[model samples]
Target chain A: MKQPIGIFDSGVGGLTVYKAIKRAFPAENIIYFGDTARVPYGPKSENTIIEYSIQNARFLLQKDIKILVVACNTSSAVALQELEKLTDIPIIGVIKPGSKLATDSTHNNHIGVIGTEGTIRSEAYNKAIKSILPEAEIFSCACPLFVPLVEEGWLNHPVSRIVAEEYLNFFKDKEIDTLVLGCTHYPLLKSLIDEIMEHKVKLIDSADAIALHLKTLLPVESSTEPVMDRFYVSDNEAKFSQIAEYILGVQPTPIKRVRLYESWFE
Target chain B: MKQPIGIFDSGVGGLTVYKAIKRAFPAENIIYFGDTARVPYGPKSENTIIEYSIQNARFLLQKDIKILVVACNTSSAVALQELEKLTDIPIIGVIKPGSKLATDSTHNNHIGVIGTEGTIRSEAYNKAIKSILPEAEIFSCACPLFVPLVEEGWLNHPVSRIVAEEYLNFFKDKEIDTLVLGCTHYPLLKSLIDEIMEHKVKLIDSADAIALHLKTLLPVESSTEPVMDRFYVSDNEAKFSQIAEYILGVQPTPIKRVRLYESWFE
Candidate 1:
């Protein structure tokens, strides 16, 4: 039995990571769980995030998964270390791959990072980039509105452009050649962000980078079997299904509503 | 011993409700809990909101309260029925008082309601308005971005104006003489919303309405005592403290961080 790869995020944003993995390995069975009930982990405390991350990992682990992907930047920044101790399976977080890519893309060693407040506060991207290029000047800003805007499906809306400009204009004077789309929901705003930055900055999308990183660590077993990815969320499935369609441009696999642990009421 | 009034919201937006209660009965001791960890219950499903509302009420009930205020519009819209069954204490929700005030303020029986997706979708305000004025014309719009924009501290920013126009423009032709600030957080945007409606719409803030309704039901026990309100949150205190100060225009009482229930890990 080929154990499937497990991916989890606070919400649907992780579907971007799922899409990349699917493209990279077409036949691999996959399980995706979105903690939609307690989402936007961006503004939550470190301890709370760690606890939620552990619960999410435990939920996915029960399915006998081969590998785990921490698709959420906030979780990757703060919970990745704790998650490593939780399980022995190869755990991949978006931070490291994203950092390496940002460093590789920046010719001037000046890079800007934008994400949720929790992720930016964690300084995971800052440290990761500095570790590779000690002299790298990393400018980080917390774009809290970006997630809601994307979730609101205002991807290319004029207001999104205004919000992107409000958040990304900080990079203009910094002369950063590369900017890391530090949150999973951020890539959906790539075009707007690109327009704001005048297409001068190379946007580091961790999805493809994570896919590349995962391929080396776990070689895909050549399989002719068709892909059947499982989707689950802690809260409403309708919103998730609708957003998933908007993001992936196709109706997602039937999504199951789940409780991370025993129902609190029960 | 005077039993304190227990008030709870999904997050700090409920502070507006707390302010109203405080002003109405300066001597009444009050307990306010912001479920910051699992906040913005606006986008969550009905079942999840009900479960969370129950947990919040349970947290407040342990304090031996005289009355309970479901300060969050989403909770009041969906969870008030369940909350009443949980406790016999006189329970007050922002919806009915707000509806009553909106109905009274409108001469033409035309009213508009703006709130989070969950609250607007529940149509509590619409139902409440119609119950009083069957001939009333109601217009409701889910202003999901309003909460994030407020939390981002863009209360009167140009971006807020643009976003307000985007959401409220739907009601332009509806000719609503009164608009219910359906979500608790909305009062923060009252000025901007007023401008978008060209000040023609009378904004009905549920906080003041809820205060008046509470007065008739639970008469204030006249006593001269300094107010020492207890504030608690399920997650980080820093963000809540800062935002509370911004909303209330005074340093909030020292806030305690707590888990609504037994820790899932423990």
Candidate 2:
């Protein structure tokens, strides 16, 4: 199938996922959308999050995509099932794969999950980890500042380290062998988080796990054709391009802006 | 004369202005709307900011308000002129009043402004300050992290202090005498910011200036009546009430949740 694979996020955090996808399936054409105008979906109510997520997915579907990946943890945790009902295309979200990977990697039966308020509040990872290992202890904290810190391009800055230490203090008393970067943006802060958590904890980014999971499902011949990547955003194409370069080490070109108004839905 | 005065913010930052209004005109009835579901209007495109502002004003106007205050700086910077045309009621925004106060407060004619990306990029304050004092030097930076830090309720937390220092580093050598708290939420961090600036600079809080300016335009008889204040938000009324209590030292009661979609707009 030549149809492009559609990927969507609240913003540039999903470029990490896009990078992973590109690494695994270099020949697969991709269409990505970052809702930059309305970034940081964590603070919004569930109804608004799901509404915006739906609008984003519809915007991507208009481009004729084969698979749609909900790269935003907020959407994955809260909007995945609703999105499944909206489209017949094969759909996926980061939470399930991330949870599965975290569950598998944990040896001490203690797992820590960190994400935005929306994701942690939904308890998507907590429930997912609990289902696989009923006796496991899942410690979760909503690290809302991480998103802003990452966006500020302060990945290695002392301020980011201070914020990370403050946020990760929740895990100091708990004995956890593994941590899930429940929010996509957290991966960018991996080194700092590693410094704070020390070397004992394994950090699960979920991007690689997700790419591998999708690989097993796609037809063997799907990768035979040369792939092309296109980027789209609701607003601020230049900023998105800059962020993409920071996250993926390559600027996303030919980016177009699309409007996701109520009329787009009805 | 019995109609309530209207105030609208993208979120609780506007409450600073609301508190000022209450202190100055305790007898005047007031209605305030906080778009908590879609806050930090700082990053959204101008068209979206304008559309949302109009919807918020329209929602407030239905209550028969005497004045419409765009308590949000982003809306004030970008949507003020357009809002005046939306209705016959006298419209006011925080930027002009704050700029006027900053101009009046500055001794060396050098001013520094810190706000969300939307506000700083709009140059609303820079232009406003220059119009009255053309030779005034303006230094502006977008502290996008501050809003999230404040929302995380870390006003005086060490993390907030670190972020403030990092963001304010740009002004260290500029030798500005007065600094404007361009975003309303910023007032909550005044003490911490004051500490960072080493108590040398005068902090200009626009809420007080806007309230004082509005006093000149209001009728002398308006304060004779008993005051009644009501709060409304698109979502998370409880959260808004909590923030109001934190910032205003009074929990807003009789807060109603209202939807501001096209249906409400119509």
Candidate 3:
């Protein structure tokens, strides 16, 4: 397939996944849709999330994407199955890759998962880890502020370190050897988290794993042409550009602003 | 005198002021606009914020508001002056009232202010306080997590308490006699903050101060009638209703969804 892969997230956090995909498959064009207008889907109802997920998938499909990546943990937890059913293209979510990494990296059979409240409440990571290593003890905490901190570009601030210390203190006594960065945004705070854990805990970044998975799924004869990444947001392009620049280490391509209600998917 | 008062916030956080205004001036109708569709304005740039603030003001002015309140601290700090120029109505920002309270309530003259990054970076409260009491010692910290936590309705959760403790501990050794809850959302975390401070620090809620200021500005004849409150939002009425019910202790009136860009202020 010569078309780009469609990646969607609730907000800019998915840029983490987009960067990983670009790194792993340099020739594969990428189309990213960040529903920035109504983001933080973590606390929204399942039905509303499913509707949003479907809308996101529809928007991606309109861009002639060969595959779909639900880069948001909240949507992946509650809306992935429905998304798969609604779309014909190969669909991937962050949960499976993260779970596998956690299961493989744990030396003590104890794993810790940290994500948004919706992701933690869904127990999706727990279920995914258990399916692979049924006896693995999974402890999950919802660090809701992590996403906003990353969005605000405060990834390495002293306050970020303080927040990491307070949240990670729970895993210190739990003997968990592997910690899953259940949300893509969590990976941006990896340095702070690692410093707090003193390099003793292995942090699993789902974005890297998902990118690896995409490499295997692509057809052998997939287009070798240089890829182009396009960014679209519902509102505030300049702010999005600033954060995107911080996360991706480069200013993203000109972000096109589109009204959600008027947007149509193929 | 016949026009309603207009208030705008990034999200539901400003409902605190909306509620307070309703209670303080019974006859003065309110028109509240919450940009829930694209919230957390604290992280956006000054230009983008000014554009959004103007758009919000235009939306409310189309509803014939006599005055405008920049209830979101971030917008007030970064875009209030720009908004004032865009509209002819009397404009009020929460920062001035908030700083006055911080200066007046402090016994030791060592006061602390906590808010979103945009607000703190603008130093609006610090400037406002210094303008009044040049000798008062002011300490400011940005508690960026408080807004998202309040939006998630995690007011009294143990984790919320832990986060509050982590954020508030910065003020513990500073011996500040008064603390300004610089963001409207911070007031919702008062119980947890009070618990963390153990009643040693008095908290200044800008919403209350703004309400009193609005009362003083209201026409005497307008105060005789019963108040009517109207709500407006950019998106997700149901989610807004759920959060408003929790924070306001009553169900919000049916919200009117407005296309802010197309609305004419004049």
Candidate 4:
């Protein structure tokens, strides 16, 4: 029960969830893996996504993790069901948490979701929102550039603002009171998106919801003392450190390189 | 006199150059290496870029290449000098050829260049153009989304067109007479870019220039039949084949997976 929670994403985007978990459950130890070598899972096929997701979960399971969180939207959209069937531990994904938040926040049953192409194309958010609200009007846009922009540490630059404006322009004339930052990377661009939406729309970040869910799922007697956070990546430690520091607003615990399949989980 | 030409890129984007070379030469054998396992070298630092570039070159050198082409713009911008200093073979990058075309095609002295943030930030094309035609006005836009869109095989799709329009809008009022498809991946979206530019601006593809340069630099022998092309990568043969086929408009020759840095060039 004292084992660390395992969090994995295609890249550092999962740090949003890691940070949220740290804030909510300060004493719980965490093991995080960002497959920086093949970070963008959104554009890949379902089979490839499943293979990568299984590898990620297996890697975390080898770390003796109590739970696994697939903190990437693309993977969640395409491989969550298969991932759940593969592992015995609870496997959480960002889509449901984000979809729930959007459905709950929408006053007029109008929700806007922005994520990578894979997530949008999968209609994961749309399906979740529709299943819950039955008649919610869902408008989804794939802001593919947001990931690279965030990775480049350009959260609020002029170009980032311009791009956010261009992508959000699709929702300008539409009536949507709530927008779900469906992709974990989108949270880093919240300020630009919020500014473009005139600060009127409520933005839902799945990280917050996932952290709350994690708190409920874990046992009450879980360790409350600060514990070490470990980071693992498939490649490029220095670049990962730079972006990780920018995204987490602090230097990451030193990142260790692990082969994708060999000796990764254990 | 019989050694094959060596080309390498971070990923399938470099296939643009491979296709051009095969078409232009027909009788010249080529050895291509795509570092699909650790791609998107554009955003990485100079040190990492040099290391990856060197590894790629070493892999190709083992194939007995007469020349080396750094098909990636990021590598050309940040690592070309290092690569040239490290190797004995005549080395070329796509930047110079693309820059030459941009300078030659521009009538109004105004040219636009679009590429990844790494390419734009390095100012490789801008410097190349300025060094050649000091009086030409240059506008550079870092289009981070274009690469991912192309990789997603969304060329000519409505979404791809919309993103292209947003990225290309900066050049519309700049009075540019020429545009350089700075990233090798950009050619995949050439039709959309050409459409958005209203056919008024000439587009320069670096791949074509590299092929021409190779033709001039390497010994030319007209064989009775076309030469066979060989492809190699660090990982994922199936995905590479699909992407290669989509980009080349023809099925890729069988690709062999090779360990990235295990080979020694004698």
Candidate 5:
């Protein structure tokens, strides 16, 4: 269990999840893969999503990670079940942990989920929440612009505030007590999202939820040296590093650009 | 010359180009492919962009197209030269046609180019403009949100106006007379963009430019029956059709989902 934890996302948005995991287990080394080349898995078909997820998993397994964290909400939503069947290793996805926390925290039994179009369309959050609290009412919206806005480093820009208001207008009348930040890139906008949703709705950041769950399972192991994290991306290392620094406040070192060989998808 | 004209884009953005081409050559059949799965080529690296473009070209060549149309700005920027080497058929890219039109349309010799990060970063329009007008001044910005905004079908949404204002504020101080919509997707936002630019700056849509260029090169042949069109995508046909309908005002017919067979990448 001393091996580094493997985390994968469609793009740099997953770096937020990696940062959370690192903070929770300071001494555990983590390996992160951002598929920057073929990102925005939100609009793609299910077969393509599953194929890329499988290929991503295979790439991380070759790195000998102890556990696989599907940090991407779209991937976790569409490919997690099939991915879980790949190995005996504890393969965890953000949807379940976040869904569980939302259900547990909600007093009104109404939860709001916001993610990429593919995530909302897949009804992953809806299904996960229904499985836990069968009687719970759920509201979901696809906020596709949020990812690009975060990538543009416009987290607090005036335009972002306007976009936030328009997208969250759906939840205003739903009487929801908890709102799930369904996309990994979303937690970066927590303050903005929280402000728009007002003080009543508890924000359920999947990154934080997943990090806490991992900590409980893999209690901090003693390490003599500081934990060193390895970074890998399918494309654009510089852009990835720049965005990583913007979101994580720390630039990942020794970043490597690795190809998810096409044959792996076959 | 009777072979169906082949056109490909990173995604539905190319449908704009397809529509423009069909309008120019009403008697010529067309074959179009949208790589919806691995789209937004605007954020990828040069090597990855070239690789995917080559694979896409290979995939379309298998269908025996007469000429190849690199309808994607990012691909045309990074891979056009290599793509030209692959076949004897005249391979044309939007950059040259659009650049030529921009240079011809400019009154002050100052031009503004707007596109994805990859396209702007590559300086395709800058080079194309400079190649013809060595002293042409170029200002470029990457409007990453426009694609998602259009895909969300928020054509005239209030938030879209705000995002446009933020992205286009760069041109306020510059004395640019011509604006190049470098990415194919930008054409869909033409009306909003026109309103924001104060109706003073001439907007150069690369799709229309490319369409006009193709007409001059591939003159319409006389035909008795109406030309038939076909569409293909690497992923989700339904979403592609939805977005295509939003932009094209008509759903493209006989759409099919085709795989870019892994071997094509090799």
Candidate 6:
């Protein structure tokens, strides 16, 4: 049996990353977890985020997966190191790949990053981008409202447009050639964001970056059958599936409810 | 020393209730618990909410509180019955008092209630209003964006005004004479909500109603000294205190960090 790759996020926002990964590796089995009961990890404290991230990784690790993916940007920013230290399995996060994409896409060294408060506060993107393009200047904004707006599915709504304009207007005078969609949920607001930026700035979606990164690291398994990807959420399976359908364009099957605090090994 | 009154919510939104209770019983000590780490319980399932509510109640009960108050309307709606079963101390929730206030103020018995998805979905306000005024007509809308907007401190922002109009416009043709601010965080948007309703509808703030309800139920203690109110939050003490100060008009001192799942009694 092929070992399933384990992917987890604070909530369904990570489905974007899941979609990208699936497109890249259609034959590999994937197990996905969303901590919907305690989501929106964006504005939460670092310790709390770290604790939740560890719990999520433990849950995924119990499946005997070959690889682990931290799909949530907040968790990627704050808890990636702790998660890396917890297990011997190869762990990948969204930040470095997206940062690499930003550095490659930008003509000028100047780039803009927008994500949840937690991600921006951690300065993960700023540091990652600066490491690659040593002379790069990163202008990052914590667009806390963006996640909620995206969750509300107001993607093309007038209010979303107004909010996007208000947020993206920060980059107007920055002379940035590329902007990174630092959070997974942000890809849904791409069209609106592009319109707001007047299509001048290249937007780097972390989902695409992480998927491409996985392609280079993992061998492609040859299989003709459709993949049976398992899904789990701490709470609200229906809402998760609904949002998953909206994001992935296919109804996710075999989704189960899980209690992460309950030790899976025992 | 008198036994302190306990109030708990999923997050800082309940500070509105805490402020009201403090104003009503200045001499009585109050203990508030905000489950900030796993907040925005509005979108979670009923079972998860009940589980979280029980955990919160257990934490507060360990402190020997004389009375328990469920400050969150979502909790008040779905978890109150479970919480009432968990404790013998007198329990007060925001629902019944606000329902009574709305029933009393409506001239046409047409009322509109707006709150989180969980609160609006529970139909607690509908049932409560119907029990009192059998002929009451209730129109409820789940204004999920309002809480985030309020938390972002965009109370009077143009985007807030536009969003409010979209939500409150549901009651336009319903001829609702009264509107109930079903969630505790809603009072901060009082002026914006009022304007969206064209100042024609009477808005029932649960904070004031809950305070009045507590007044009739409890005897006033005789004390000239300032009452000491202890605050406990599951996470992000800084954000909680910052928001608390904004809602209460006074900085909350001696706010402690707590782990609700760690079993305080054990």
Choose 5 or 6, whichever is better by TM-score.
6
Candidate 5 regions with alpha-carbon error over 4 angstroms: A225-228, A263-266, B260-266
Give the distance in Å from residue A253's predicted Cα in candidate 1 to where it truly belongs: 2.1
Q: If the candidates were sorted by their DockQ against the true structure, best first, what order would they fall in?
A: 1, 5, 6, 2, 3, 4
Candidate 5 lDDT at A188 equals 87
lDDT of 6 by residue, B72-92 (tens): 899999999888888789999
Q: Give the TM-score of candidate 4.
A: 0.71
- Using lDDT as the yardstick, the better of models 2 and 3 is 2
| Candidate 3 per-residue lDDT over residues A138-199, each given as its tens digit | 99898877777676577767666766787888887888888999887888898889889889
Q: For candidate 3 chain B, which ten residues in a row score worst on lDDT?
A: B257-266
- Model 4: per-residue lDDT, tens digit, B124-161? 88899999999989999988777766765668667667
Instruction: Kindly give the number of clashing pairs for every candidate.
Output: 0, 0, 2, 0, 0, 0
Query: Which scores higher on TM-score, 4 or 5?
Result: 5
For all candidates in order, state the fraction of native interface contacts they contain: 0.42, 0.28, 0.13, 0.08, 0.42, 0.41
Sorting all predicted structures by TM-score, with the top scorer first, yields 6, 1, 5, 2, 3, 4
lDDT, candidate 5, A157-237, per-residue tens:
998898899889988789999999999889889999999988789999988889988977797866787677888887889
Q: Which is the winner by DockQ between candidate 1 and candidate 2?
A: 1
- Count backbone overlaps in model 4: 0
State the local distance difference test value for candidate 5: 0.87
Show model 1 residue runs off by greater than 4 Å: A225-227, A260-266, B224-227, B260-266
DockQ of 5: 0.44
Q: Which stretches of candidate 2 lie over 4 Å from their true place?
A: A222-226, A262-266, B222-228, B260-266
Question: Candidate 1 chain A, which ten residues in sequence have the lowest lDDT sum?
Answer: A257-266
Docking class of 4: incorrect
Q: Please report, in order, the local distance difference test score of every candidate based on alpha carbons.
A: 0.89, 0.86, 0.81, 0.81, 0.87, 0.89
Q: Chain A only: list TM-scores of all candidates.
A: 0.96, 0.95, 0.93, 0.93, 0.94, 0.96
Best by TM-score: 6
Instruction: Give RMSD to native, each candidate.
Output: 2.3, 3.0, 6.3, 6.6, 2.6, 2.9
By summed lDDT, which 10 consecutive residues of candidate 4 chain A come out lowest? A257-266
DockQ of candidate 2 is 0.36
After superposition, the stretches of candidate 6 with alpha carbons farther than 4 Å from their true spots are A224-226, A260-266, B224-226, B260-266
